[model samples]
Target chain A: MTEILFYSLSIIAIATSLLMIFHKNAMYSVLFLLACFFSIAGLFVMLNAQFLAVVHIIVYAGAIMVLFLYVIMFLNMSTPITIRKSKLVMFAAVLTGLMMAFLLVVSVWQTQAFGQHPEIVDQNIGLAKTLGKVLFNEYLIPFELTSILFISSMVGVVIFNKKEVEDE
Target chain B: MNELINLKDQLRIIPLEHYVFLCIILFSIGVMGVLLRRNMIIVFLSIELMLNSINLLAVTFSVYHNDASGQAFVFFVMVVAAAEVAVGLAMLVLIFRNIKSVDINALNHLKW
Candidate 1:
């Protein structure tokens, strides 16, 4: 049963990701990418990280994709038509993807998958409570630092995206 | 529920190598998008895809090790990804304001 769930969701992820790439319209790409996120979230759930799954949907499919669509619309009021790359460039990109895939898989596969894990996950380490404890305890410093990063990035956005009409 | 526990047991039946391969393919596809696509937004999205692929690997390892640190890192990844989109889109807006197109090729010359 889990196998069925895993394979199906992976297929959905793969298909949507490809469509996200091949689609010319930026809007279509955004929409397809949303599908990809949803499937990835499903995978997360299957992996027993339910909290991260919900967070994934909220952040990626909800917030980030909306931002992408907004930017796409804001950039050009009309529909966005992507300019095609040269055939040679396209071939090179495919070749690079293939080569990188081969190298990464061969190297990683050589390493044993991981340390011994119980056959059954049997624990709720993925639960929000467990994760929160870790975040607020051992990783408290990095957790606080993340907030600083968020603030700086917000300020950077405001500065960079300030409308220019006021300057005129 | 008993069924839920049983389902998790089924998950254990699957080995970790399968996930590694899946992530490898997904990450490669992301790299393909980043290399092949010219639109700045698509490139940004591709970068997100790559990040997601890495997050999958991280979470998988965490699950295998029964550690919460991996999940904590996932939180950080999400935070960073969010901040990046905010600033990146802002830059995109600024670029569009200065030059009317979002095509990376058109913006190639530094003077423009």
Candidate 2:
């Protein structure tokens, strides 16, 4: 059952991402990306990262996607007019990405024996309270610093929008 | 609770190789989008895809090793990603306002 679920979810994730790449309309592409994000959340759940799975949906599909849609709409960008790079550039991009993917596949296949075989993960690892403990205990410095980073980003946003403040 | 463990056991039946390959393929798609697309928003979206793929890989290993630290790091990745996309889109908005377009190719004024 898990195998079937993993296979289907992965296929959904891959297909939606492909649609995002090929869609000419930015809105449609964004929508496809949202589907891809949700499918990834499902994969996370399968991986026993239940907390990350929920947070993934809340952050990526819920908050970030809304922001993406808002910006795309606000800008009112229509279909891009084929910002035509040469065929060589397109071929190069495809070739390089495919080469990287092939390399990754070959390496992953060869290195499978190095790691111990998979087993049942601990339930405590994936829940919020368990992660909360680790976050506050082992990762306290980075946890606190994330807040500082968040604050700086907020300030950066305000600074960037300063022109609009002046205009209004 | 026993049933849940059974499910987790079943999850392990799917080889880790499949997970790694899936992530790499998705990551490659992201790379392709970033390299080929001229639209800044799509490029940003592709970047998020790449990050998501990495987060997936991290969580996979975390679970396979019976560890929690990797999942915690995934949370951090999401937080930083949110901040990045927010600031990046805001800057994109400012650029659009000035140049009246979002095509990245249009921003060549800095070139002498």
Candidate 3:
């Protein structure tokens, strides 16, 4: 059952993500990316990280993607912008990505450290209560620091969007 | 106890390697998206995809090691990603206001 769920979700995620990347229209790409995020959330649930899954949906699909759509609409990108890149650059970019993937896969495959452990120690570590405890206790400092980061980023946004008053 | 066992059994059905490979594919797709797309928004979307793939890997390892730290770290990553998108979009809007284009190539010359 879990196998079925995993495979289906993985397929959906990869397909939608590829569609999101290759789609010409920015609006369609955003929608496709939204679908990809949903599938990733499903995968998170299958991995027993229910809380992370929920938060992923809320932060990513809810907040970020909406921001993306708003920006896209705000820019009024009705006409698809044409980017004329030479075919060689496109080929090199694809080759670079493939090489990176190949290297990562090879490295991961060679590392036997993670291969020996098939047994999960605690199945409930992903539960919110446990995660919350860990967050508030051991991760307390970093958790609080994120608020500072948020404040700074918020300030940065406001400042960046501030109107420039011209001197007469 | 029974539910815990069931959860373990369900998780065991899929190996950790599978998740790793899945993340790798997703990450590669993200890299390609960033590389191949000229639209600044799509590039940002691709970056999000890459971050998410890493988050999934972290959660997989966290579960494998019975550690909640990975999930906590993923939480921090999401926070950072959120803040990044906000600022990035704001900058993007500013750029658009100046040049009226989001094509990455449009800003090739910084003097614009």
Candidate 4:
């Protein structure tokens, strides 16, 4: 059962992400990416990261994708005119991506430690209660720092979007 | 009978290599999206996809090692990703307002 779930979710994730990249329509790409995010969330659940799965859905699928759709509509770029790049550039991009993937896979294959599956020591490690304890106790500083980051980002967004005053 | 097989045992049914390979595939697709697409919005989406793949890898390792800290780290990553998208989209909006286009090619004045 676990194997079936894992394979199905991974297939959905890979297929939707591929569609997201290949689809010419910006709106369709956004929707396909949303599907990809949902599949990833499912995988998170399968891995027992239940809290992270919920948060992933809420943040990526719920908030981020909505923001993307809004921007697409705001810019009126549903069907963007494709500026055709030369065949050479397209080939180079695909080649680079493939090379990167090959290098990563080779590195992983070389690591003998990765072949040994480690047993999960704590069954409840993914639970929110356990994670919250670790966050508040061990990671308190970084957690607070994230709030600072958010505030700064919010201020930056406001400044960037603020209307410029023109002198008459 | 199902209660006899705990969640941990069920999770162990899938090998770690499978998760790693899945992340690799997702990350590669994201890289290709950024390189192949000219639309700034699509590029941003690609970046998000890359971040999501990393997040999944982190969570997978966290579960494998039974470590709460990795999960906590994933939380922080998500927070940062959200802030990044907010600022990035705001900037994209500003750029669109000024240039009237979101194509990366349109901003090639510095490409001398």
Best by lDDT: 3
**What DockQ does each prediction reach against the true complex?**
0.67, 0.68, 0.69, 0.70
Model 1 whole-model lDDT (C-alpha atoms): 0.84
Q: Model 4, residue B24: displacement in angstroms?
A: 0.7
Cα deviation at A106, candidate 4, in Å, is 1.5
lDDT of 3 by residue, A64-163 (tens): 9999999998889946755437888888888888999999999989988887564546778888999999999999999999999999999998777665
How would you class the docking of model 4? medium
Q: Name the docking class for model 1.
A: medium
* Ten residues in sequence with the least summed lDDT for candidate 3 chain A: A159-168
Reference-based TM-score of each model? 0.93, 0.94, 0.94, 0.95
Worst 10 residues of 3 chain B by lDDT: B1-10
The best candidate by DockQ is 4
- After aligning candidate 2 to the native by TM-score, how far in Å is the CA of A43 from where it should be? 0.8
Measured on C-alpha atoms, candidate 2 has an lDDT of 0.87
The CA lDDT of each predicted structure is 0.84, 0.87, 0.88, 0.86
Q: Candidate 2 lDDT, tens digit per residue, A24-110? A: 888888999999999999988776678888999999989999999999888878555463478888888888889999998888888
Per-residue lDDT tens digits for candidate 1, residues B1-112, read 4554454575557778778888998899999998888788889988998899889989888887778899999989999999999988888888788888777887867865
Error at A91, model 3, angstroms: 1.0
Candidate 4 has a DockQ of 0.70
lDDT (tens digit, per residue) of candidate 4 on A1-168: 777778998999999998888788999999999999999998887777788999999998889999999989988889755734788888888888899989998888788785665654566778888888999999999999999999999999887766533311
Preferred candidate (lDDT higher): 2 or 4: 2
Residue A71's lDDT within candidate 1 is 79
Ranking by lDDT: 3, 2, 4, 1
